[model samples]
Target: MTLLKAKSILSKDFRIGRASDRLFGSFVEHMGSVVYNGIYEPDHEAADEDGFRKDVLELVRELKLSVVRYPGGNFSSGYNWEDGVGPKERRPVKLDLAWRQVEPNSFGLDEFMRWTGKVGADAIMTVNLGTRGIDEARNLLEYCNFPGGSQYSDLRRSHGVRDPYKIKTWCLGNELDGEWQIARKTADEYGRLACETAKAMKWVDPDIELVAVGSSARHMPTFPEWDRTVLMHTYEHVEQLSLHHYIGKRENDTPTFLAMPLEMEQQIKDVIATCDYVQSVKRSSKRMKLSFDEWNVWREPDVPYTPWQTGCPYDWVKFHMEDALVFGSALLSILRHADRIDIACQSLLVNTIPMILTNKGGAAWRNPTFYPFLHASRYGRGEVLRLETESPKYDTKLYTDVAKVDSVAVWNEEKGELTVFAVNRSEESIAYELDIRDFGNVSFAEHLVMNHERLDAVNTADNQGEVRPRAGGTTTLNGGRAESVLPPYSWNVVRFNVQSA
Candidate 1:
């Protein structure tokens, strides 16, 4: 194997932008066991007075999630928010056509908001524009944000929430470009509805922000066009555009899978260009940012599961050690584009391709992909510093000019700390060096690395500690230069604290 070498230089003065706290967000949809047995299980031994799972809530807090998008992915397209508001005993068990599961309607608007409070995270509500329209969107906004003296606000009072939830961000719809969605529409169709709905929603609560739907994926036939058209119509009405993409692998191409971040980077760049072009065409003063509402590693089984049933448990995606590496790379991609993409959510939070997996009535465990997210959320706050990198390059079957090492640096000025998140994508162990500028009396804080002997090794509920991050030894800062050996296919976080020289 050829020796791989990589070097990166970062400075506190050269920064991308102040990282948005909302960038560390996750999603929760009413699909699979994500709702019923995942987060809220009254019968579970770990349940609290409010029936929310204490175990899951603790893990969620540990992840340091800033915001959570609620109620649906595809489920929102067909969801009737009204059906879920009343008492649980009276609430009917409705069939969720999106996932073919039965939504008990037991956990509705109030319950989710309550859970958000318990987890200490804000909410980003997504409205139904597929089966519903502007009227319903306006009503939901009024019910959630309006204080009193109105019918919807009074209805919220009747539902036991005297204070309004005051949700700030709202999604017009989810994945209108995909055929899998209910009442899917063309770009023009979704644009018109989204524009009209956004206007009416702002008419109800002008202070709130809106996210218009973009393409479901870059591979979609109408990706750039969809983004262009949607922005052309709703650019002046909305504050952000929504994008969703899930990385998956087949036939065991580990190198290709690890390099998937390149693809994500391209997609983000294309969308940014499209947004800018639209701004120039309309001569609009406002610039559109992105909300990556759904993203994760989804691997399909050799044989697809047959016979989907209501309330039946399903394990959609079980992540391995390699997936964590890719997950780290994905976060780095988002950090690189932190200037424009302000918000992101890592798909489902519980079961069915979740960061944390639960054992129904038993225990909850963090998957391999959880640690990278944890480290990013904890140390990756503050301003993102730009890095000048010199790394070995290679080519994969699908991706060319691939960097053997990928990395991002975040400088927390308030805490006087700097964090460098790096990934060694090459098959051979590489010597990595980082040079710091304009800093004084810096000391190496911690070097945390996530690596496994087997790339596909996983942690189960019984053996939850099997695949976890461990200390990757220590580093010494000599004149602001730190060096370490990045193991082959490893995710490393090197942290340093600054002091007076």
Candidate 2:
């Protein structure tokens, strides 16, 4: 077998931007077992004092998530924040129209906040802009952030806590442009409502940053226009605009599926262009950032679940090794645009196409997709270095001249470390070279690779280690240059310790 060749030139001076810790975020929605058996299970053997699963929390802590979006996805659009605050017994049990399930309200705002605190992550709360509006949004803001004296603040104080939650980041709404959304709005209508809600919420707590809803996905007919119109209205009030993308295999087309991140990269660029267009239109100097809050590989058909049942098993699709490759590439795409994208949450943290899966009263296991996220969250921090690469290219059904090797580099200036994340999209091993420049003396530290012969390999509760990362790949560094062999259909992490000459 012949080896494909790839090389990337990296310099210390060339930088994209300092990667935001919030970029390594995850989402937790009230949908399905994501909230119930997913994270909160009182009967679980590993239950904590707060009723959150200690086993799950251990995994979450290991993931090193910086921030978590709460009570949402589509659920925030129809949810009433008030219902989720008070005592558990008094909390109302309502039908979740969004996902066609019952919401017991047992795990509400306070519980979520506590859970986030325990896991050492900040909260990005979303308000209900579909079934509700400005007043409710401001009230929820007041309840969470206000110190005291106001009705909502005092109400929060009466619950048990005297201190304010003071969550700084917020999402104005979910995907309101989708027809499936509870109160799906026209672009103009959503723009107006979002602007007003943002204004009122800011009036209540000026410190909070707002993320206005953008189009649900790039394929939405209203796409760039929807983002433009929304930004046109909410530009001054909000700090970031939200974008969601979920990649999946189409007709067993692995090449096409892996190339989907190219689409994701373009979507980020298009949204940035839209934001700039809106900025010019408004003549506003404030540049709008983006929050890619909902993203993952979701391709499972809807599974059957009893209606109105608590902790119903839903969307428990086990991710395969092929899925992890796409997931890793998608993450690299996000990292490449770290300058403009402020926050990103991999859809659901626990079940529902998640990195981790849990049984109702059994064990919690890592999915194949977990390793890429884990590697990125752990080492893919600090400055994103600009890499000029030349790699062997191949043509896919949907993409032309697709690079066999896709890669990105991150330099942790403080830690004196430079890390390179690369993916081999081809079925053959690639001889890769790192053309290090400008940085002083450096030595290869480690190389972690994830590769499995079976693309459909998955980890179950019984065999938790069916698919995982291993220390492999031959890498050596000498005189500001490194050489490594990337395995076929693999995700590789190459780290180097930078030293001053």
Candidate 3:
């Protein structure tokens, strides 16, 4: 066993930035059963009038998600938004080229907006820049945001939506640099398209913010170069650059997998450097932020992804307890970089290795990774406080000087609360000490820890509570200092209620 010692200091002066609720966003794609059987199941007994599963909606609401990116991941690149609007009865059934799943135009623009409203989350629409271009994007923007005068707006009225959806964020495209994407474009091609599309869409609705596509993954041969070239064309037109990363487990190494968030941190840094490089070249004052719109722990497909299968969808994998630790670490990494990363979406919200998983006509249960996100979305709000930790280090196969503890602090002034989220990456328990500075008297409100005897422990529909967070009582606060024994490979959240601080 390894003896790990660590200390954390929190001060209000050392703050990163205010946390955007958008950072707590999640994705809803048309792939697999994420749509048909995941969030929406018309015939499911628990479904609402809009065909959305009420139980799933309850969980989504519980997550307190701020923004939901609608209509696609890769699916958006090949999607036709017009097909899913108007009357569901007359809606045409087509094939989704990206996911190879049957596209039953039943749930489209109007349905998604309604669902988003019901869940109290903002909607971020993605335009198809792959198969379609600026014209289609502008038309869709007009349809969704215009107020009943133009052709597209009037068409929206004819579809029974009198008021504009007034969506504020739009994604110009998705993963244009990846060869697997339909009509994948070169950096120059995508950047030009994104720039023009953003200009036209803003012309229709100036209130909106646009995100230009960055490299699909950090390892893409063109990674930081792809970001730089895209930013060269879209620097002024877009507000954020979109990034997608799916951390996978290979070689069955827990320590290496736990250190994956380090890679994500480096990816964000590389993208930031690329963005600044373009800003320097253009001599522009504008600085680009990031939208990590698709992120989660997923494995590469066991089988080659088959195309053109109308009814077939991507396979779903059950995330184990170890996956939850990694997911929590990733969220911690995003929070630590809160200044630059304003928007992040956990890839597919349900049914496809997501936070929530459901069986057709059976049950929708929270996966092992769900609780960590739930805690973050609920308590991980307000300003991000820079936390410095001194701890024993270990080297992984991929990452060196890996700290035994990865943590972040959030100070919610209105709530008079300071929440500390920490993950123990070591194989032995860490007796951690926490010290507070530049703050008034506070009391330890609660300590919640999620740990299991076996890192491979998993939760199923019937055994959904198998791996969940429970109250941790060992942490004690004396004066302004606190001490606790962080369990081996655990995600721990310690909250302090400020008393007139």
> In candidate 2, where is summed lDDT lowest over 10 consecutive residues?
299-308
TM-score winner between 1 and 2, please give it: 2
TM-score for each model: 0.97, 0.98, 0.97
Best-matching candidate per lDDT: 2
Rank candidates, lDDT, best first.
Answer: 2, 3, 1
lDDT per residue as tens, model 2, 1-501: 667789999988899999999999999998889999999998888999889999999999999999999889899889999998888999999999988888889899999999999999999999999999998889999999999999999999999979999999999989999999999999899999999888888888888999999999999999999999888788998999999999878777888888888999999999999999999999889999999999998868345667678888778878889999999999999999999999999998998898999989999999999999999998899999899999998888899988889999999989988999999999899989999867877878899999999988889888999889889578987777798899999999999888866
Candidate 3 is scored at a TM of 0.97
The reply for model 3, stretches above 4 Å from the true place, is 1-3, 300-313
lDDT of each residue in 1-501, candidate 3, tens digit only: 545679999898899998889999999988877888788889999999999999999999999999999887889888888898888888898987777667888888898999999899999999999999989999998998899889999999998999998999999989999999999999999988888888888888898999999999998999888888899899999999999888888778999999888889899888888888888999998878999999999854322444554323365767888999999999998998889998999988987778888888889899889999999999989999988889888987778999889999999989999998989998899978889755778888999999999998877888989999999646988888888789999999999998663
- CA RMSD, predictions in order: 1.6, 1.2, 1.8
Candidate 1 Cα misplacement greater than 4 A, ranges: 1-3, 301-310, 472-474
In candidate 3, which residue pairs clash? none
Angstrom error of the Cα, residue 362, model 2: value is 0.3
Look at candidate 2 and tell me the lDDT of residue 306: 71
How many backbone collisions does model 2 have?
0
Q: Once model 1 is optimally superposed onto the true structure by TM-score, how far is the C-alpha of residue 125 displaced, in angstroms?
A: 0.6
